[model samples]
Target: MEPLDKEQQLERLYATPPVYEWELIVNPMHFRTKFACLLSLTFTFIGVGIFILLPSLKGLMIASSPIIVGSLMYPWSRYLLNADKRHYYAINKYGMYSTSEQIIPEIAYTIVRRSAWVGCAICVFAAIFIGPIAFVGAGGAALMSFTMTNFRSVPHKSQCLFDGYAKLRNYRENEYSLYTEYYHYGFDLMIPESKLMSIIGVIKQYNDTFEEEFVDLYKDSKFQARPIILEIVR
Candidate 1:
């Protein structure tokens, strides 16, 4: 008789339905944006120093400082707080993908919206503090600040393979809520970090010897569907 394997053991336990089948793809735009935001925020602090501590810019400081700070810091803080949760998957015969940008555009929009309000509020504050010079200085700073803060990812040649607008979906199970992004690649996968059992389950389902339909899913196995799992050492 053949040796009983781990996959065989799992098949006997935790019976899963076909319709709930999922292929997970990890897209790390959030992690990358978090790093970028942190860097941008640091630069914003430097700009603040130049505005406040530098004696030469004292006359223009109030207006410029808020503008510069708002422009840079606002976007940085916004993206940091609201960066999207993106995932990629292929469902049935269709390719579907989603990203945080698609799922929570309001979160991103709110950041910019608040920054715009800050610019306007500073303009009023400047008028109260000084006069025309203050207003001009404050307004100019605010405009620049707004410009820097609200910058977004534009579709251009330089974007990475994972960078682009993708589809978004929301999942609600009992009390848990999850946001997912699906990227439609003709045939590309973004591997995600998940629980060891979850990963094994996907592999077992796909590699099930009882089913030959799994092989038909991908035409090419070379770069297409290479097994990512090995024996779990326990």
Candidate 2:
């Protein structure tokens, strides 16, 4: 059993899953749904700061803040809140994949949707108890949540993976998002900090000895998919 285990581990390490099936574990209830109350408070502070710092742009800031928060924050926040669900995806070396044919997201989406009502109630409560200042702020945040698009990852039956290797992009809440002068077909993803150190190790290995399909893009000169740190800008 030990020998077999070692053999399997080696196989997984070397074998590329070009046309294999992998289940992406996704939480239906994502953390962003929980940001409603917090964002409401933040807007209040920003509003106060703007009013204090530059009174002239109060109207402009007030009008634009919601639009900004709604457009960027709202959609990103949608990714934050989700129910517990698993999405099945198939990826190929050529950058193609397929998802379940279901047109709608998992039932967990409804649960997260309803949770927004609770989020609304929290905002209303915060507005009342926290004072009129907070009330205004909460209203703005709630409005953004409402008017802003709640983007969801709609499952498709099948699709081609955009051709590109996974590039290293480290996103921290504190840092601004970085730009890439060169663009590739693959999407940029945020990896867990814990896994980051290990990723660097893999890249180093590829530099030392070009192997591992996962590391192929990073070393290849044609695409030059070298790692570039990316952060999500708030």
Candidate 3:
């Protein structure tokens, strides 16, 4: 029989009922908890600048543009934080499936268009003072940003099959989340803290090479101080 294609694999994965399921809602004030004062002061200054510098409608809009753009950081950060957005995860012996809120394409398109315009403006400003060479750097920056934004805008469903070699990392700080890696691709599953061991046991049955370790597989400098409670590599 021919090997299943990507779509077929997904359909099979989704059709398989999960043995375990859970939901996670990240802290709504996570950002404010970290940057409350800084963000508040920054927006306050922007508000003052808008009123003081821009007396006319056009000037007001232009001057307030920074605030308008900066304001997006809140909703965008909240979206990234998954604030108040409940994420659901389902897992069975065959694989795991997860879902989260999807982003609106219209909003994504607006952001992309504004980003390109900002890049164009920067290019023109730089070219006026620097030289024609500025276009090269600015154009490259625009292209890279556009590409990254477009790629991220595409919807993605996080899922993985357990029929192959895989790695697992359980962070000590977050007892409710499990991070798994298959090949170079990685995804996270949020499970009840009490059931972590039971879930690990289920995974171990399929891949006996699973073991515990303190080492950080990703070697991320920031996470170096964050202890890993358990790690399994196959």
Question: Candidate 1: minimum summed lDDT over ten consecutive residues — where?
Answer: 170-179
- For this target, which candidate reaches the highest TM-score against the unseen true structure? 3
Tens-place lDDT digits, model 1, residues 1-234: 885464553343223322223333222242454556665566555556545654454455553655355455545554543343333232221112222222246566566667666766666566666566564335555565456456454321111111222222111110111112322322233333344235334433433221111114334444331323221211
How far in Å is the alpha carbon of 31 misplaced in model 1?
A: 6.1
Cα-based lDDT for every prediction: 0.39, 0.40, 0.52
Which residue window of length 10 is worst by lDDT in model 2?
Answer: 173-182
Candidate 2 lDDT tens digits, 10-118:
3443355644343434333334454654664455456566456545543343433433343444434444432233445433343323343222454544644554554
Please provide, for model 3 over 75-127, each residue's C-alpha lDDT reduced to its tens digit, 9 standing for 90 to 100: 44444322343456777766777775433446665665566466446445555
Using lDDT as the yardstick, the better of models 1 and 2 is 2
- Model 3 residue 135 distance off true place after TM-score fit, in angstroms: 20
TM-score of 3: 0.54
Answer with 1 or 3, whichever has the higher TM-score. 3
User: In model 3, which runs have C-alpha deviations exceeding 4 angstroms?
Assistant: 28-37, 50-61, 64-82, 102-156, 175-182, 216-234
